[model samples]
Target: MIPKKLASSLLIVALALPGCGLVLENRIERREAAAEAAYPSEGRFVEVAGRRVHYVQEGRGPDLVLIHGASGSTRDFTAGFMERLTDRYRVTAFDRPGLGYSDNVSEAYEGPFNTRSASPAEQAAMLHRAAGMIGIENPIVMGHSYGGAVAMAWGLRHDPAALVIVSGATQPWPGDLGLLYNVTGSSLGGAALVPLLTAFAPEAQVERTIASIFEPQEPPPGYEAHIGAALSLRRASFRTNARQVTGLRPHVTAMSRDYPALRLPVEIVHGTADTIVPIDVHSRPLARQIPGARLTELPGIGHMPHHVSAGAVVAAIDRAARQAGLR
Candidate 1:
């Protein structure tokens, strides 16, 4: 009964849909191949709450747990920082949920809410459970950027000996994460456009994006190769990170209100030149709020203090361990 013109249009769309799906599948395979080639898992996995959580463990002393920021893997610490901590502490670095080699726990969240991805709090719970599996008791929990938010969540509910926040997005920002995150985080864009980006975005573009995150200072030599930036380009990782970031504001707002209850030692390291997670907006106010919290400002450094200013981060950890009476 449909008009001839409309029937023809429907047929055209139906034909195009399969072709588009094929293209997406081809893209996904290529992207996944690139990810595996560049960053094969360098850590062990433990089944935590029905999901395999990837973690890197090394050294022998007081336990220390490292959580990488959004879109980063355990390699973020293995690149260089973990060595510094291993000499005095057993360092275990984790890839946040839905990132790197860690299993995506979005659907496995225990809460009553229906959500596609794990929130920061849920991620903290999963990682904390992973820690328990490995016998990490009251370890110093450290998080950078988005991972910092999860660390705070852990400290609020758990009994971490100390909390170290490095360039953490502790406070909620006022506005959006610009156009890229807004569009990619939405359901429509995530389903339609993420595959195209994963399929064909040039490696140069990915390199450029990583460089920008370490702004005010060029990425350390061989940084691109060591960090496995391609892993971040996978469609699943891209979509999960976009969702985590887009939904972060309210979570940070809710968590920050409970900052006072975190009575354990807290060490915060931030860069004055960090435009990504502005120091003034997050760390400074955090230092003022947490009683006896210490804030160390890295002059002229950008967002990645763990890379650019390794000694300061180590010192903060030392101070925290000492304060927690673990050293």
Candidate 2:
């Protein structure tokens, strides 16, 4: 009973949809190429269980391992933070699996529609194996933001000498992570929308996001260039990061119960003004959970205390080393 004109329009629209998808996929690939070329890997890789993990190692004293936050790579540390510690301790900064140059924890998680992510424990174990391969033993482990959760998992499951959490997301927050994570982590968004973002999300918007993460303070000159924000925009990294962050709360909630059992030296540094992971919600409660944990509160600093207040972070690390008898 349909009119010929209406049927023709429907057919045309249906035909165009596939063409549009092809165009978008092509754009995504090109953008990924551009990003990779602009910010090539700056470190070596170690293969663990058939997957590659990228890391930058420097310094020569006691071993120290650094884990970066969500949407970050080892570049987050090499962007100057590592330089501060290289004189005192042997440092290794790792690109957590799926971000930066590292491979996803599993090939199955690389599919666009798949929403599963590597848990903090799994990430810890994989990185620990890589550390063992590198001959790093009883190193002090430090994590920033999302990396903090992985560091905590490392402390619990492995035998790190000490731990330092810089603006870490260690405990479960009260609310959901909002629309960006909620949507991008869903199956439909991961499949249909991530390509569009990969192709079209602007660099200015990324700069603004970087600025916001350092709010109440500004990113140091050249920080944007060195951090390589675009690297996280690739389709697989974007999907994996979103899925990991969205699914993190349950894991952190489960991990909280084991904090009291940890006997390692623990040092936590957080900015009072940090909106990304509030001091009251994460670091303060975290300091209370672990026995003999030291908490340093940086007033007027935001999420990036390691950059803005590098001295304090380094001091905390030194304290942790001393407590663990590494200093």
Candidate 3:
């Protein structure tokens, strides 16, 4: 249950934003330092949907495409993870429609990233197009949370080498609007209540919450800066978040019906403790409904296990990849 006092307090904070933009200088300072440190600078930029997408590909073998969750960019899945896979498979992760450096089409009821990008079907198709643009044929596809839905939709239509989901929802999705409006609130609202949500120390907790997908409970010292950069430098980040809440709900519902027909070597991963997008809503049902799906539930992890529990997530991906005979 959301606290009345806290909600009211946050709303007051919301009243203060010049816009939903957070601070950027601090965040960029951190990314330039950490990303290059994690992997050599082989970042590739491409044009998709009338916008430029930032992506990173490493290693050489069967291609693996990663789709990130709502309001998240490819950065959510760091290059460090790619480094681990460097010797074997080629890995690719992209900025979703409105997030990151992708096209900023997150207007309410607008074209592209509005509802179209919100729909798993459309997103999956777009992701496939992006893959073709990058010249990756029959790439293994993977996604987390909302990204999981897009990946599932894509995998269903076409046979990927394999599908790996980390806390990925295979069925429909439900959004929390209270959380949505809160994100739309001013930067102060985000900062003040962020600590409240995570129970972390109060300073910059909101940014930490966003970055948590990449770093989880234990954030690297400068990651908070990246959150600020994402919120501030990138205009569409929060707009996309609100749109995900208002627009994606029905698409998720629509996608749920397709689970019975889900055919592929698929591995679904989730954390039972996930407060966001509970497993019961879709993941579990899809696991049961999809003819040959395998479910792996991580006991104490949360939604972003790839970031929160990297070792376990990587192991799961490796298992799924092996199951698909990538080795």
* True-structure RMSD, every candidate: 6.7, 6.3, 6.4
Give each model a TM-score: 0.92, 0.94, 0.74
Residue 301 of model 2 has an lDDT of 94
lDDT of each: 0.84, 0.90, 0.62
Better of 1 and 2 by TM-score: 2
- For model 1 the TM-score comes to 0.92
In candidate 2, what are the lDDT values of residues 202-319, reduced to their tens digit?
Answer: 7787888898889999999899999988889888889999999999999999999999999989999999999999999999999999999999999999999999999999999999
* C-alpha lDDT (0 to 100) for residue 9 of candidate 3: 64
Ranking by lDDT: 2, 1, 3
Say which prediction, candidate 2 or candidate 3, comes out ahead on TM-score: 2
Candidate 3 residue-wise lDDT, 106-162, digit = tens: 233243123323567766776677788998877778898878877888877767877
Model 1, 1-327: lDDT tens digits are: 112343344344434575577766876797789788868999899998679999999999999999989789998899888988898999999989989988877464322122256778889999999999988998999999999999999999888999999999999887778766665676755665566567766777678778889999988887878998778878778778878888888998999998987789999999999999999999999999898999999999999999999999999999999999999
Best by TM-score: 2
* Highest-scoring model, lDDT: 2
